[model samples]
Every structure is written in C-alpha cells, then in structure tokens.
Target: MEAALIAFATTAATLSVTVVLALLEFRRRRREAVQARREQIVGRVLDTLERATRAASRAPIVGWWAPNELEYALLLPRLLAELPEQDNAVATWVARRIQHLQAATSRREQVAIGADVAAKVVQWGR
Candidate 1:
C-alpha cells in the first residue's frame, strides 16, 4: 500500500510539472506570435510610407497637395497612435517618421505647404 501511494504521488507531481511547463511554453509562443504579427504590420506600414514619400518627393509647386505625400503625412500620426507603446523600437521608428514628415512643412512646394496645412487641420483639431 505504501509503494502504491508513493507511485501515485510521483505520478501526480510529474503531471503537475508537465502541465506547468506546457502552460509556460504556450504563453511564450503566444507572446512571440503577437510580436511577429506586430512586426509584419510595422513592415507593411513602412513599405507604404516609403512609397508615398517617394511620390511626395516630386511634389509640384502649386496644388492643394500631392496626393501621395499628403497621404504619407496624414497617416504618420494615426500609425503612431495605433502602434503599441510597450515596444520601444516601434515607438522610436514612429518618432523618426514624424520628424521626417515634418520636413513637409519646410518645403517651398505649394503641395508640401498644403500637406502641412491639411495635416494641421485634421490632426490638430483633435
């Protein structure tokens, strides 16, 4: 009877340890998946902003705004707000993007000026 009890206790301990390990592993994997998804989203946004900035670089002197540049400028703030603040790298990247886009306000192009005004109008209002 003592031997049986010992065996049962050993089995229960092992099972408990295994369950704990499995839970830990699951939590680890879930965190990694969330981080991976966040990276993918950030990458997609970077590609889009890159394309828009490229188009905006060729902005005309007189217009309400160059559509692509305007889009890039406007999306900066929303994207900054949308990303999780817990990730320092993401926050740093977004800060740099905001700085880069701020150059629009300094450009001589009318489209750039319009982009600045539009961004101010839409973003500053809130």
Candidate 2:
C-alpha cells in the first residue's frame, strides 16, 4: 500500500508538471503570434501611408478626386481594426498622416516631402 501510494503521488506530480509546461508554452506562442500580427499590421499601414504620399506627390492639384486619398481611405478601416491595444502613438501618427494626406488633397496643394521619414520612424521604431 505504501509503494502504491508513492507511485500514484509521483505520477500525479509529473502530470502536473507536464501540464504547467504545456500551458507555459501555449502562452508563449500566443504572445509571439500577437506580436507577429501587430508587426504585420503596422507594416501594411506603413506601406499604405507611403503609397498615399507618393500618389499625392505625383497627382495634380486640379482634380477633385485625388487617387491617393481614395486609396488611403479605402485602407484606413483595415489598418485601424488591426491596431493593437496600448499602441496609441502609432495610431495617432497614422491619423496625422491621413489628415495630412487629406488636407493636401482638399487644398489642392503639393504633397509633403517628409512622409517617408514619418513612416519609417513609426515602422522601425527609430
């Protein structure tokens, strides 16, 4: 009876340890997946911003429908939806970039030249 009890306890302890390790691994993988999704979302936002900037630069001031603004508007929802919690800075920066793009379009003015810098800084965290 003593030996049987000891064996049962050992098995239970080992099972508990295995369960703990599995849970830890699961948490770690979940974190990594979230991080990867965040990075991918940020990257796509950066690309859209860059493309809008380029479009604005190349677009003429006479047209009411700036292609860049249209494209950006189309992408805004997806980008906003994917933004992670506690990423207010990035969200704000993206908003500002969108505002600038729209303002430049509405005013029929030439696009700003610093879009790349803003996009890069946001993306690379530099």
**Candidate achieving the largest TM-score:** 2
User: Pairing residues by index, what is the TM-score of model 2?
Assistant: 0.70
Per-residue lDDT of candidate 2, residues 1-126 (tens digit): 999999999999999999999999999999888878877876676677666656555636634464755776776677667766676566666667666656653323434433543555465542
State every prediction's TM-score relative to the real structure: 0.56, 0.70
Alpha-carbon deviation at 44 in model 2, angstroms: 1.0
lDDT of 2 at 105: 36
lDDT per residue (tens digit) for residues 40-93 in model 1: 655545565555555556645533454555565666666666566665555455
What is the lDDT, from 0 to 100, of the residue 41 in candidate 2?
Answer: 74
Compute the lDDT for candidate 1: 0.58
